[model samples]
Target: MNMPPTATDAIKDNLGEAGSHLKQAASAAGEAIKGAGSAAGDELRLGKANLKAELADSALAGIAAAENMGDAAREQMDVLMDKSRDVLDSASELIRERPLTAFGIAFAAGWLIAKVARSSNK
Candidate 1:
């Protein structure tokens, strides 16, 4: 004849199985959380590195553009100065060749313009 299990024995067996299941679930949850944290940390590091590179590139580009603008402004000033020198030299030559004539002509034109302007105001 075989004996059947007692009520206390059955209860103990059920409690042991429930405890094992709980332990497995907790271990799985811990592993999942660890994996997720590592992934997030890696992504954050990569993003920061990319941002740094982009900022560096932008700063370099701005510096290059500023340098180019400076060069262009300097070139334009040189051209303007050369043209002004040419014009002044030409004027000097004209004055040397016809000093008295140039002065008389300038004085007469100025007097005539002044008189015309005064009459117009009236």
Candidate 2:
């Protein structure tokens, strides 16, 4: 037959039960921490991907704007070149129609330039 339980035995049994409950609580807490860390890592990766996508889109938009600006500048240069050609053609036609007048104008311009140069030197 079993002997009645002693005071020491009762205390030992209570301590063992308390230790098991503590272990269970610690395990649960560890699992929760792991899950939280995994979720945080996933969020960080998604954020990085989104940031990269936005940067790419902005870069593409900037490139498109530069191309459009280049095209517009090219068109303006073409117009300016056409106007210059027209002015040159008109001047040539005028000179051909009035050779003596052109020669007299050139002589006057040369004389005026010489006078201006002499005055500047003085």
Candidate 3:
């Protein structure tokens, strides 16, 4: 003989199905949250690496600029030294060519310097 389900029995079955659905929904939501956290962590690590690379590149560029400036300064100093040497060499040649005139000019310059120094002291 077939018997019909009672009201209490029907409600029990419906409650069981509802509980199972709720568990599955909770699990799915938890998995979604975990995946989002992992993705956010990955993005942070990638951003950190990119920032380090850019800073290193900028530091290297600054070093290269300083080195270039140093090279230019050295070149300028070399030019200045070369000009000074040329002037001194020309003066030496002129002094050698006219030794008597050179001696007279030196004596006059020394006398003038002595006079100026004495006046300043007074």
Candidate 4:
């Protein structure tokens, strides 16, 4: 003849099964949190690297613009010097063509300027 399990024995068996299931659930939860922390750290590292790359690109762009401006300023100075030489050549030609006239005009201008300055001072 077979005997049925007692009520106390059945209850203890159910408690053991419940405890095992709870332990498995707790382990799974811990693994999920660990994986999430690793993923977050990877994202933060990528963001920092991207920011550094962008800053380097911006600095390089600024340097290139400054170099271009410097080149333009040098070109403008060359043009100004060429124009100044042209003006000096014209003045020399005029003076050579009429030396006495140029000298009389210079003296007259100087005298007029002096008279005007002295009167203003008084």
Candidate 5:
């Protein structure tokens, strides 16, 4: 005997189909969200690494600049020392050629310094 379907049976069958479809959609959405989160985390880590690398390169450039400046300053100092040595050598030659004149100049300079000192003390 063929039995006709009741209203209750039809309603129960429809509800079961709807519930299965909803569960499948929910699972798909959850997986998509997880993938998006993982992708974002990977991008964030890559950005941090790139920033660190750039900073390191900048630091190296700065150090190189400082070293160049130091080298330039040392070169200038060497030039100044050479000029000072030349002046000293010339003065020494002048003193050797005219010992009495050099002595007189030194005596006069000492006297003048002593006089200035005494006046400042007063």
Candidate 6:
């Protein structure tokens, strides 16, 4: 004879199925959380590496700019020094050609400087 399931037995079976589903859902949720945490860590590491690379590139660019400026300044100083030497050479040649005039110019310049100094003190 075939017997039908009782109400209590049916309820117990349904409860068992629901409990199994719940456990599977919880396990899936835990795995999803772990995956999300690992992905976030990977992204953080990648971002940090990118930032460091950018900083290094900027530093290299700054160094190149500074070197260019230094080179330009040195070239300008060299030009100024050459001009000063030329002027000094010309002055020396003029002085040698006209020693008497040079002496008179020196004496007048000294006298003027003394007069200016005395006026300023008063």
Best by TM-score: 6
**TM-score of candidate 4 against the unseen true structure:** 0.52
List candidate 4 segments past 4 Å from native.
1-3, 72-122
lDDT per residue as tens, model 4, 1-122: 77898999899999999999999999999999999999999999999999999999999999999989989999999999999999999989999999999899999999999999999999
Could you tell me every candidate's TM-score relative to the true structure?
0.54, 0.54, 0.53, 0.52, 0.54, 0.56
Residue 45 miss distance in model 4 (angstroms): 1.2
Cα lDDT of model 3 by residue, 3-121, tens digit: 89999999999999999999999999999999999999999999999999999999999999998998999999999999999999998998999999989999999999999999999
lDDT of model 3 at position 86 = 100
Candidate 4 minimal-lDDT segment of 10 residues: 1-10
Clashes of 1: 0
For model 1, how does the per-residue alpha-carbon lDDT over 33-111 read when each residue is reduced to its tens digit? 9999999999999999999999999999999999899899999999999999999998889889999987998899999
- Find the number of clashing residue pairs for candidate 5: 0
lDDT of 3: 0.97
Candidate 3 off by > 4 Å? 71-122
lDDT of 4 at 76: 100
**Better by TM-score, candidate 3 or 1:** 1
Give the alpha carbon lDDT tens digit for every residue of 19-64 in model 5: 9999999999999999999999999999999999999999999999
Q: Can you list the residue pairs that collide in candidate 3? A: none
Candidate 6 residues 1-122, lDDT tens each?
87899999999999999999999999999999999999999999999999999999999999999989989999999999999999999989999999999999999999999999999999
**What's the number of clashes in each of the models?**
0, 0, 0, 0, 0, 0
